[model samples]
Target: MLAWAGCLGYAAYYSGLDAVAGISAGAVAGNGVHGAVGWLFSTGDELGRAGVYALTLAALSAGSVLLRRHGVRELPGAVVVLGACWLFLDSHIFWPRGVFTMLAFAVGFGLLTVAASRWSGRLTNP
Candidate 1:
């Protein structure tokens, strides 16, 4: 379940990047009823859709590798999901600039995940 939450977190973060870049990106890469397929290959645009793909793939692969390598267990799925949701929603409006608080929340969310494991009786004690 934590793995899924991790995936969600990665996806949401990328979505936020997409919002910042103002590009369609992979958010709608393969939609059946859309011409957005070409959006990923757009070269005229500075951001270029491939950047999104790269960021997304990097996030997913890195997140999975780091989680598995460190034997990180006991991640609270709710915190992840909620945090991702908040990020996705907040990313929709980047003009006013609120990413600072979001960054703090992300840090807290990471710490919370570890703390959740400890408090849930899985870890001996932090």
Candidate 2:
């Protein structure tokens, strides 16, 4: 399917960006930004990865817009909250803590899905 191929292509493009950024910053060959949040923050040159995070936010916001358009009102707000968590609050969601990190994403996604569905139903019904 063209949609699947498009998704894969975009995935490859972003992966390439991460690889280029990570490798050029002396990260290991495969790990994007050294493969963990701890490493991303702990790196000596904070400014070096500034572009990476900026680009990340930019790309993510595009999806956030799609979320908003699809009736998932929480995403734009979540993006704001999570972006703040990543930036000002320094939340541990970005840390590498075994399965806890994965759990965080899973939970966040679960909440998002629930909220989105509820809002989606409301938007459609009303």
| RMSD, one per candidate, in order | 10.9, 9.0
* Residue pairs with backbone atoms closer than 3 Å in model 2 (clashes): none
Which ranges in model 2 have alpha carbons more than 4 Å from their true place? 1-10, 13-55, 70-96, 122-126
lDDT for 79 in candidate 1 is 39
lDDT of 1 by residue, 1-126 (tens): 554554565556555545633444444653562565454434313232333334344444545554554445423433353444444333433434446435644664576566555555667645
Which residue window of length 10 is worst by lDDT in model 1?
43-52
| lDDT score for candidate 1 against the true structure | 0.46
Candidate 1 ranges beyond 4 A from true positions? 1-49, 74-105, 108-126
Question: Candidate 2 at 6: error in angstroms?
Answer: 13
lDDT of 2 at 54: 47
Q: What local lDDT score does residue 87 receive in model 2, on the 0 to 100 scale?
A: 44
Q: For residues 1-126, what per-residue lDDT tens digits would candidate 2 score against the true structure?
A: 433443454455445545544554455534554456445435523432353354345436544654756655556545543443244223233454524534644555565656667765753655
